[model samples]
Target: MASIYDFEAETLDGRPAPLSAYKGQVVLIVNTASKCGFTRQYEGLEALHRRYRDRGLVVLGFPCNQFGQQEPGDAAEIASFCALTYDVDFPMMRKIDVNGPKAHPLYAYLKKAKKGVLGTEAVKWNFTKFLVDRDGQVVGRFAPTVEPKALEGAIEALL
Candidate 1:
């Protein structure tokens, strides 16, 4: 079966990043926005990264503007905002559409791997999360409002 490792994404700096590089790690891939109500989730995400990184947790942020254009900013601008406002240290990828023809390849694979509420694979908003196991299999899909702390137990079990 195809795994998440089969996908590749662009870094915020526009370089190719093969998901295979995250092999053997429990990865939490989140679609993010800077101006949305759920933007504050960055704090919790960063906390999750710090708390479990040594245990193979890889939290990846992909700033997307598909939902109400909440992340309308250039690459440099997003980087500055994350660094200055949230002190974000986790890996963040280039801005990309999460729900259209232009959707990032990584997101496409994630949605195909894990369906959400009502058996829908489409992402409804920013902060939607896809958690993958160590073997590159997508495990669970989380709604945008599901707080990062709430994922601790599931993540621990996967680890």
Candidate 2:
């Protein structure tokens, strides 16, 4: 029984980011893109982070270019775009493949925990979100169309 905390990834700055560091906190892990139509969702994600950070919610963004090459920027460029365009303050991870042999291990676990529509394990697009409980268990999987604000209730329940 591996918990979400068992995984590790790199931050935008290429530093190791252990999910264990987020233990006891409700986490929203989202795969993001800079040039996609859903890029504006970054603002909503930031809002969710600000609104519930004190209540034990943390939003983590992971940039991915797997889908349609929507996120073609390097780590530095992605960070700048997130900060300047959406004022995103949530922890943003380094770009990684989200749906292939090179997919991040964390993502592999998440998809196994919660499959998408029609029981598909593969992520259909960017902005897909995985919600983890305080116990480090992945509790939910949201589609790209699910707005960040709409997750307030679920986050509140975990808090």
Candidate 3:
């Protein structure tokens, strides 16, 4: 049924990754940016990953430069920044577009499955987050302004 397992993405190093590897794990898929105002959320996201990874929760970050070019950096640079700034240990995908024609297919499917505020499918900005269940179904969508710590309860419930 076109589950997330059907999608293949590139890692921060540009290596191919199939979502099937994360099956049966609750995943928090977030579109992120390094220079945006919402960049601080990386800390909270990493915290969530560290806290619940033992409980089968995986937080995946997908860097996107679409929103005002806030994430203008190559994979290595982004990886380094994330590691240094937030101590992020979770997996992160290569830079991708989350909206418009260049949008990644996985993101397109996620958007269709769970629209944001006012039935909008197009992402409004950076740090837009999607909560996915063990079955790879999208369960919720959080706006960019929504702080990452605010998702702890929802994430715990899913885990």
How many clashes (backbone N, Cα, C below 3 Å) per candidate?
Answer: 0, 0, 0
Between 1 and 3, whose lDDT is larger?
3
lDDT of 1 by residue, 76-148 (tens): 9999999999999999999988888988777888898898888898999999999999999989999988999
Return the lDDT, model 2, position 123: 94
Off by over 4 Å in 1: none
- Per-residue alpha-carbon lDDT of candidate 2 for residues 33-145, written as tens digits (9 for 90 to 100): 99899989999999999999998899999999999999999999999999998888999999999899999999999999999999999999999999999999989999999
> Where does the lowest 10-residue lDDT sum fall in candidate 1?
99-108
lDDT of each: 0.92, 0.94, 0.93
Q: Give the candidates in order of lDDT, highest first.
A: 2, 3, 1
Question: How high is each candidate's TM-score?
Answer: 0.97, 0.98, 0.97
Off by over 4 Å in 2: none
How well does candidate 2 match the true structure, expressed as C-alpha RMSD? Answer: 0.6
Clashing pairs in 3: none
lDDT of 3: 0.93
Off by over 4 Å in 3: none
Angstrom error of the Cα, residue 74, model 2: value is 0.4
